[model samples]
Target: MPEPTYRQILYASRSEAGIDVDHILQQSRHNNAVDGITGLLWHDGDHFVQVIEGPESSIAATYARIAIDPRHHDVTILSDRPVGAREFGYWSMERAGKSMQDGAVMLARLERRLTNAPETVRQAFTAATKR
Candidate 1:
């Protein structure tokens, strides 16, 4: 069978007070697997930068749920478009965060993963890392 038409979204948001990143990751991994979605979610204690890709309908439904999630505030869409293939296909929901021992290592890995991503998406991740 031919490859499914994939849609990807890059978005950023501020975490609400006392938000649990681990809980979000657990839920995302489970839901994304069932929905055939794959992507990364990065957090820096206060903010989030994520890239989710999958079938158009799944992406739409997932994002619709994200947009209204009370755990997030100031949600912003950095990029939204159809893609030829998954840019973050290796993980159902990989995560990077300040919780890591070496942020530089995480940033380097994120940069490499985004090597095939759109320029706008790349820029958004770069900016998110700096924050």
Candidate 2:
């Protein structure tokens, strides 16, 4: 097979107290759109599970920024690998959370997104959303 052109990073983190998730989502959408990145960000009240995928350079730069962001702590990487194509290709940054009014719908969509993801990545999201 040909080499993968995209890099994907799946990670989980503990959200810092009083951090504005709305602001973070807004900022991420803008940045990811400009940088040609796409992914899902599932943030419960106290934790985060995300899957970011894009060009190799963009993914590297984006992950670098995320690594130093103050909104979250203990940013543990669940998976880092390359893919031949984008998996979460529909959104620049889609936000999912149990706090939403349409949470069941959001979770169903999230399950679809993780349908082909690694078991560990899927489990991380499952655990976080359940909390």
Candidate 3:
């Protein structure tokens, strides 16, 4: 098969009313993924990790929409890795909502990352709504 062109877009949004994050991430019926596109979305209660790959135009357009999408909170492009392979092939969009803790089980990874993140990121995180 030919190599794939990957462009990642990460965004955050509060969990919709009556909708579980896992359900939104695991289902392949989403209009975006249903088309000839492949990607994954992950939510850690505060932010998200999104990986989308396809033709450049579609990805760009989609990214624009995602930025303004009301369903999502803080929509930002984490990385637009070109020609990168999909990491979550099993899921058109995999949503992992569990707050993970290290083996010590002392601190939440999300909180740790947020605290450690640069001042700019921390500010953005604070402004963004959590899922």
Candidate 4:
């Protein structure tokens, strides 16, 4: 069967701003073992966006590798759609670490997951993002 067309994927995670992404990307090299892996890494306020493209199998397989890799965790898919340009332009891992301002990303996600946060808190976050 022909491979599925590549899909655009945008994901984010929050971690310490000082975290070294260079190290993370290098670690993934041997672990993922998939060829043509290339991408860009960027961070803003602790939020990260990574664009990776290639064979669907490679993408899916690498995601598994990323999840298991100790370098990163709590990954979230913010947006995904078919885009004309492959932002990453390669199949390698682009580890975009966190920024200090967006440090709340993990806390916010955890709040939603545990269902311990109040409605007002969630609403405030939503309102803040819209602006």
> Pairs clashing in candidate 1?
none
CA lDDT of each prediction against the hidden true structure: 0.82, 0.83, 0.49, 0.49
Alpha carbon lDDT at 128, candidate 3: 45
Window of ten residues with lowest summed lDDT in model 4: 106-115
The residue pairs found clashing in candidate 2 are: none
Candidate 1, residues 1-131: lDDT per residue as tens digits? 87767998878788898898899999999999999999988888778988899999999999999999999987877777788888789899988876666656656755665556678766666666663
Q: Model 4, which residues run further than 4 Å from truth?
A: 1-4, 16-18, 28-34, 82-85, 90-131
**Candidate 1 regions with alpha-carbon error over 4 angstroms:** 98-127
Q: By TM-score, rank the candidates, best first.
A: 1, 2, 3, 4
Per-prediction TM-score to the true structure, in the order listed? 0.79, 0.79, 0.53, 0.51
lDDT of 2 by residue, 86-130 (tens): 878999998887876766776675566555777876777667677
Q: Which stretches of candidate 3 lie over 4 Å from their true place?
A: 1-4, 11-28, 99-131
- Most accurate candidate by lDDT: 2
Give lDDT for model 4: 0.49
Q: Which stretch of 10 consecutive residues in model 2 shows the poorest summed lDDT?
A: 106-115
Candidate 3 weakest ten by summed lDDT:
101-110
Task: Kindly indicate the candidate among 1 and 3 with the higher TM-score.
Answer: 1
Tens-place lDDT digits, model 3, residues 1-131: 77866554433444334445565554433756654456555455545545555567767776676667555564654334455564434545443433543312211322343433467655554444242
